[model samples]
Target: MAAITYKCPNCDGGLVFDPSSQKYHCEYCLSDFTQEELESLSQELVHRKAEHQEPGLREQERREQDRREQERREPGGAGAQPVLYTCPSCGAQIVTDETTAATFCYYCHNPVVLAGRLEGQFRPDYVIPFQIDRQKAEEIFSQWIGRKKYVPETFYNKKQIESMSGVYFPYWLYSCRVDGELDAQGTRLRTWDTAGMRYTETTVYDVKRQGTMEVDHVARNGLRKANRQLVDSVLPYRMNEKENFSMGYLSGFLAENRDMEKEQFVLDVQTEVRQFALQSLQDQAGSYSSMQVRKKEAGIRDEKWSYALLPVWTLTYNDKARGKIYYFALNGQTGKICGKLPVDRKKIIILFFSVFLPLFLLLMTGGYFLG
Candidate 1:
């Protein structure tokens, strides 16, 4: 469950983080509070879990208490019955996922970040703030669809365009130094002609090279329910710009803890770094006409892992006419957009026949005249 929503000290209104201002804002009273101030006011709520445990407990009881606390600290999808917390301003019960870090109240539109959701192991190490605000996202979405010709006009309705939100997707960034060697057989062809007889010979040579490479951030998105393909299409965040994690940054925006473990993706990270090392070695063998890799050896000398939140603007359009859904995603930091676009079948067929029929008739008439 979320710790609780922060209440405005001046007007008793629910406070929300504003991405534009990068501070908690109260529309009711026009008051602004820094995240530090809010944290100070709600520091006691972080220990609310301890308030429920019994003062004196047996060994098994203490272990059970510890396990329960660990479960609360971890991120997961709660059952359909979401844990509900009452909005401090409106007393409205706010339903949320078990792992959600921040959300806004539906009744009062008060944006609140769950202070406890970002505590301990659940905390992110770095965060890339939303560089592209929602207003810019709307314009980018408009320009993107305007360039796509075959999309049904209904797909760009005002409602569909306005539904986008800035979400910080969870990711694990792995950095490591890799040193490896690659072995390959490279072939170069030699041809010669003498006394009207041609002879061709192919020379095969053993090739090997050693190199070192550093991978700063190999990112893996964390939400299990999010479409991996769609999420990955907007990749390659600028790790150089990431800031140390702060719950204050999450106030106005949506953020979440990772649902997947880093161990689950360790092999994938290893494969990526190894592939880079091997490819670098192969690039050195450019003189060969063709090469086949024979052996590979790679190892990570040092490994570092960081939990981060990367920004993404996503929109999914359900095309009712074709009974298919099209997803459009943009990198909130880079403004990169990618998705599948549906083509108009009827228009394609008409254009094909219209252009082909004239050419076919002209060829037939010219043949008859020549005959």
Candidate 2:
């Protein structure tokens, strides 16, 4: 309903969260405040407004709250339409899609969000801020493409490169401890030669192994609509560095709400933990030519899942003729990269014919002439 800006208490300037400093920065006054300090200050503002405002103003605010809640719960609450606002820093008009919770201003480059977009299911419990910046990401991309020369000239066009945006992906991070047991029949083969006679003997043993193992930081993407495989490929953020959720970390980046809940990933998390525990005990099963595992149980005693935002650099490009969209992902913290790259059908065909044609001709001539 209104443009809300995080204001600096000292200078009343628009405050932006800086990634390097992990603090809120005032663009106009250059004041810096710890994230906790600014949060406390925000709480103070809300309390002062409620206490000092007139009764008529309070009534209006209450009515507005009711109206907003009704719109969200009613049919076709809010969809498709992007929120429009002017940047408090440079007065640039900005528009963001409905699902977008956080993004940067194009003109002034300040991060903006419709505070409503980050409530309830859309809110993140923790966030891993971007450690890799644009220049380093570009260098990584360049190194990746420099080795492959035939990956369509249009892939690296200025527009597609510029579209490489830092995005916070929603993930369900799980930690669990499983007490597991494994049962299997293990076999050992023995061979002996004596007096020109060969003899073979097989020894079999029933093995039972049990142990407790803990798995931490098992991640699954929470957005059903996004490419799950692509998201999984980027994997493995440094979960140890995760910090409490705050809008300051999301500044100057693109972010979205989690479309799926922790419930969706529960089975997957349990399954992974089970497999890990089984393998852990299986490693202690001694030596065998082959062992077929029979019963394996994780007995997953405990599990915890938290909604987290992991950072990634996302580059998406389309092959219009092939009608396919390709993605390149760079780990925002570690700079590890992965993606699908298009293959040139023409080059493959040429190489195939070059290697196979001469051999086919030689075989044909040898068959006819030698016959």
Candidate 3:
């Protein structure tokens, strides 16, 4: 596998994508380049890769064969073996799992994108680049943590805060059109007083509604091994801001290739779409005292599926004392946050007594004076 790293044209320093400036920056040279400048450089790198592709192909094939042999030798077929890539800058071995498309080199501390993992069908159709930079994300996290009074201090310490990572999580975006028809019965009641006597009348009517509805950009998590709750809580990404997929956008972040396919979510998405169509038709059934649906039908058409990568900042804290794990995720575009924080039981106990004890003593003293 080829581990590709973007290099600064002037100083040859490793280039990282900067979210705040929307440009690539070289740490050593303090120089920034726009995407246009990097496009030509990328093309040249492709040409160079093509010129020396034969040896890399042979090495990849040999590694695959060895992995297959190893799997066969193990009982019940062991899972996929870790893949190794040589870092372009420092020549250190970068070890990663099958789903890891981009990561950092531990020895050299430079970002590397595994180009082979994201080529061909594995490539994403769209990417929402990180808008909230690391500093902004850390500030947001701190503000959120500061609001919770009983949270443990260890969760937001400097060491733990430094562990936060910006990642591109894979998702499947679904869009479709629905043709729906609804049949229902509605009733209205009328009451009046005439000549000192009460009169009542009830009327029933049949209602029918038919319409076509368009639904777009329903996202579903596409990585199977990820935590579904953590990934899903930071939803509602602005689809309008998405840009065409480019490997350069992933330079300074961690990214994962999707193992799950769109087919896995088709049934669930279709059911949700149908329910929404039916409910919408019912809502238009007009004003009535009571309405009951007699028949409803919906047909989904023109289904569309898009593979995309969305940005998130994630942190994990393990509360070993309680044997529990807490997760924190922030939306990289909107700065929305979702987290599970460790509560300090001692603080809660103190707060409980501090407020109620004073009130209790005042009540007792007043009762004694009245007696």
Best by TM-score: 3
* Best prediction by lDDT: 3
Of the two candidates 1 and 2, the one with more favorable TM-score, higher being better, is: 2
RMSD of each: 5.1, 4.8, 3.1
Please give me the total number of clashing residue pairs in predicted model 1. 1
TM-score of each: 0.78, 0.79, 0.90
Clashing pairs in 3: none
Clash pairs, model 1 backbone: 17-252
Candidate 2 lDDT over 270-296, as tens digits, reads 887787778878989999998988887
Candidate 1 per-residue C-alpha lDDT over 171-280 given as tens digits, one digit per residue, 9 for 90 to 100:
99999999888888999998899999999899999998887888798999877767888879999988898888876666566776677889999998898788888877
Q: RMSD, model 2, all Cα superposed? A: 4.8
Q: 1-371, model 3: which lDDT tens digit per residue?
A: 46799999999888889999999999998999998899899999889967877987878866875664455346456435687789999999998876788999999889999887776667899999999999999999998998999988889999999999999999999999999999889999899999999998999999999999999889999988898889899998999999989888999999998878899999999999999999988888888888888999999999999999999999999999999999999999988888988998888889879988888998999999999
Instruction: Judge candidate 2 against the unseen true structure and give its global Cα lDDT, from 0 to 1.
Output: 0.77
Query: Cα RMSD for candidate 1?
Result: 5.1
Pick out the ten consecutive residues of candidate 3 with the lowest summed lDDT. Answer: 70-79
Better of 1 and 3 by lDDT: 3
Scored against the true structure, residue 163 in model 3 reaches a CA lDDT of: 95
